[model samples]
Target: MKIAVIDAQGAGLGQTIIKKIRKEIEKDIYIIALGTNTFATSNMVKAGANVGISGERAISSFCRTNKIDGIIGPIGVMCSGSINGEITPLISKSIFNMECTKYILPLQKHGIYIPGTRNLQIKDIIEEIVFDIKNNLVLIS
Candidate 1:
């Protein structure tokens, strides 16, 4: 299975998500780290992402052309000017257009809060993302 972990800023969340996927999933999954900046991409690459792409054009281009099974990232990924203005309109549009399931982390900083997700730790959220991916694989297979 192929999946994308999108992030911006320092990409700490992306790195964490990638690491969990590597640990929790035994399948030979291909991970793509889609970051809004070089630093963010590099961090996820160091965390074992199979491939890393940085910058808005590269991210949007990959998203438009690739066929991914799933995408995990902050809720801001689907919003323009999100991630402290790092998320571009094209990126948001591309993510929205992709034919895949999206696993959004409802981080309060994004300002589009989801009720009942509050008080959950980042580690827990990452686990949920991995669990969902595993469940999805069973359904698809």
Candidate 2:
């Protein structure tokens, strides 16, 4: 499965998701780190993502062309409006609107415009995702 992780300015949340995924699932999964900026993407790559793309054009183009299985990031990942206009909405819209199953963290005030999927802690969300994947796989077999 190809899981695209979007990070704006390397809040370090994206890396946490990748680490949990690797520990929980045995299947081969590809992580495509899409950073709203260079810093975000670089951190994700160091955290074990196979590929990393930074900048607006690359991020937009990749999301438009590819079909990612899932996406994990803060809700601000959708709007792109940051504190000082660092991460713009264009980058966020590209990934959020793309055809991918989304598991977004609630980070609205922190520059993520997350409307739904709120009030949940990061650890709880990650646990849910890992449990769901494992349960589904077991049922299938």
Candidate 3:
């Protein structure tokens, strides 16, 4: 399976998610790290993503053409003008239009609050995400 992990800004969250997923999933799943900037992509790559790419066009084009099985990122990924206005319209549109399962981390700092997820820590949230992917794989198989 191929999964894309998209992030921006400092990429701390994306790095954490990549590390956790690598530890939890023993299978040879390809993890692509897509970032809004070079710093973000570099951090995720250091965290063990199979491949890393940056910039608006790179992200949009890859999502538009790639056969990604799943995508994981903050809620800002789907919101145009989100992530301190770093998420462009094209990036948001491409991500939203992609035919893949999406796992969004609920971060209230972006002004996009997910109900019932207010108190969860980032680690717990990532654990849930990994669990969901594992369960989905079982179902698919």
lDDT of candidate 3 at residue 88, scale 0 to 100: 98
TM-score of each: 0.94, 0.81, 0.93
lDDT of each: 0.91, 0.75, 0.91
Encode model 2's per-residue lDDT on 15-128: one tens digit a residue.
Answer: 887778778874767788888778888888888888999888998899899987777776666655653465577777787688867876665476344455567678888888
- Ranking 2 against 3 by TM-score, winner: 3
Model 1 TM-score (2 dp): 0.94
Tens digits of per-residue lDDT for model 3 on 1-141? 888999999899999999998899867678999999999999999999999999999999999889988999999998999987879999999999999999988888665667898789888989999998888777766
How many clashing residue pairs are found in candidate 1?
Answer: 0
RMSD of each: 1.3, 3.0, 1.3
Error at 81, model 2, angstroms: 0.8
